[model samples]
Every structure is written in structure tokens, then in C-alpha cells.
Target: MKNYFWNMLINIKNGQMAKKSVIIGPRKNICESFLKILWNEGFISGYKISPQNTRNLEIFLAYTKNGKPVINSLKFLSKPSQRIYYSSKQIWKIDSSKTFIIFSTNLGLKSITECKKNKIGGEPLIVIN
Candidate 1:
């Protein structure tokens, strides 16, 4: 499924800038629904990351239909300080003018907090279940 998603993103990147933000969280029914929502909204260049693989931190950078940078998702290994560090790095890679909305479960709260503390600019819309 991961490979499939990667391929789909690659294809979507061939066109213009996609107005989308990266989503990271546990792999659940809601997460899939979120992807569908983005797709239907013309936010096709995106990526998903499961909690189990958060430590590795995979980043997916795609362009919008107009050639703007749209980072869909970034996966980072969960650790005491890694989230803040990775968030900074990810934020640096993209255009600061572009806004990013992150979706995650409660498990990501700590990381989200770290991002806020560092002023990474990623507005996290956490979903609690």
C-alpha cells in the first residue's frame, strides 16, 4: 500500500502545484477517509504515515498543478526530541508562505507540542478517539 501511494504521488507530481498538506497519524479508518477528502478537494499530492514507522521519517515532496511545493506527509521516528528536529527540517524544505495542516491522533500530541515550541508553522488538527 505504501508503494502504491508513492507511485500515485509521483504521477500526480507530473502536473502542477497541488494545494495539499501532509498528514501523519495512526493508520485507521478515519485516516483513509481524510485522504479521500483531500483527493476529492483537488489535494491529490499528499502522503500518509503510520505510527509504527514514525521513527524513520519519510518525506514526500510534490508539486501543485501550478508548480508550487506541496509536501503531503513527513514521517519521523518518535523520540523525545526527534519530532521537533524533524519538524524544523521539514518546514525548512518548503516555502514558508505555504501553510501546512497536520492530522494525527493523541499519540502525536507530544510531537505536536514540540513543533509549536519550535514555531515550525505546522498547524496540527488533532483527532481524538
Candidate 2:
């Protein structure tokens, strides 16, 4: 089985490092919702399913006015080797103006504020700064 999560993030990070305008990768599970969150939060420009290949996704990278990538870094909170979970209350403890944490809750992937708003605890998947 392919690990689309790792593949997706790595592509974005590498693309930003290279200052690419776009990058393509396999579609992640619940990709639409996840990508929508990132898009709405201004982390990414947007993403679309490939016309020739449905399993693939074409991601439009976002940049600053000076031509710098909006995404600074990505931190894995949970991995296949080691999973991590946090309570809704614990979500409040996370403090960062420029960054937000993505968690896999019962409602699928949600950000810190969403998790707290829904009063749900889940595995912290990635911390995108």
C-alpha cells in the first residue's frame, strides 16, 4: 500500500524548497476535505484531481508577495511506527499564530480549532507551520 500522506507532504515541502509553482502527487484518503482545509486556511493555493488520472492530484502551491512559499515547515505528530493522540482540552494548549495542527478525529481530518470546537480528541497527524 502506498503512504499517500508522506508522499503528499514531501512533495509539497520539496516543491517549495525548489520554488516550484505546482506539484503533483497521489490523492490522499479524504483528500478533498483535507486539502480544502489547507486551501481555506491559506496554506496552499488549491488542489484538483488530474483530468487524465483520477488517483493523482495537481496541487497549486502558494507563495508570499516576495515569492516565498507560505508553508514554512511540516512536523509529523504521528507515524506508522509511533502514533500519538491528544484530548480536546490538550488542543487548547497548542499556541502558534502562524501554524496549526491537523488531527484525525471521528469527523476526519480537522484543525486544532475544529477539534476543540467539536469537543473531540484524536490522533495529531501533522503540524504544519
Candidate 3:
């Protein structure tokens, strides 16, 4: 019984030591540009979704080769208004154990602010025109 309990405790501890992941939402061209920065800085190991394919808010989730959590993007439903609703819901789905990054341009400031107000883990990285 003692050995079994110790084994269980070890398993739990290992699970808790898992690295956190990240989520990223790139809603504008400038946001996409900053993504390159994140990638270069090694702050994010990998990323899902692409700016070129953001027509419907369907973004990607990136992970490290070692399976470490990295970054993710928001998905969109039909219609533009649905984007807010879907993005909010997606933000809520973000794992608390992971980090979230939101990339937005000047034009997307309002949207990023709203996301922040909603408790989405994102900050505006300004893009100079």
C-alpha cells in the first residue's frame, strides 16, 4: 500500500510539472508581422494558424517538438459579428496553465482591447505604419 501511494504521488507530481502552453490571436496583418518576432525570440516554440488564412478567424495552435505548449489562435464562425462571440468563447477555452498572446494592429486595437477586457490573455503590440 505504501509503495502504491508513493507511485501515485509521483505521477501526480510529474503531471503538475508539465510546461504551460500559449494561445495567440493574430487578427490583422500587423499582428502577423509580430508573430515573426515571437517566433524569432523563442518565446513561442511553434504557432498554429496563419495570417494569410484568417478570413474566418480560424487560427492555428503551435507546440514544441517536445510537446510543450506554445501558442494558439482563435476560430471564427460564420458572419463577422459571430467573430466576437466565437473569439470570446475560444478565449475562455484557453488553458489556464498556458499563456496567451494576441497580435493586433492599430485598426484592431479596439477589438484587442475588448478581448483584454473580457480577460483574454492578450496585449497589443503596436505596428508602425
Candidate 3, residue 36: Cα displacement in angstroms equals 0.5
Candidate 2: lDDT of 122?
A: 96
**Any residue pairs clashing in model 2, and if so which?**
none
Candidate 3, position 124, lDDT: 31
Off by over 4 Å in 3: 1-20, 50-53, 56-129
Query: Relative to the unseen true structure, what is the C-alpha lDDT of residue 32 in candidate 3, on a scale of 0 to 100?
Result: 44
TM-score per prediction, in order, is: 0.26, 0.91, 0.26
Cα error of candidate 2 at position 115, Å: 0.6
lDDT of each: 0.40, 0.84, 0.38
Candidate 1 per-residue C-alpha lDDT over 20-121 given as tens digits, one digit per residue, 9 for 90 to 100: 344333344444454554444344544556456853222234455676654344332322233323445564554433443342333332223345455554
The backbone clash count of each candidate, in order, is 13, 0, 6
lDDT of 3 by residue, 47-85 (tens): 556456653122233456777434322222222223223
Q: Candidate 2 on 7-74: residue-level lDDT in tens?
A: 77888889999999888888767666678889989999999989989989999999999998899988
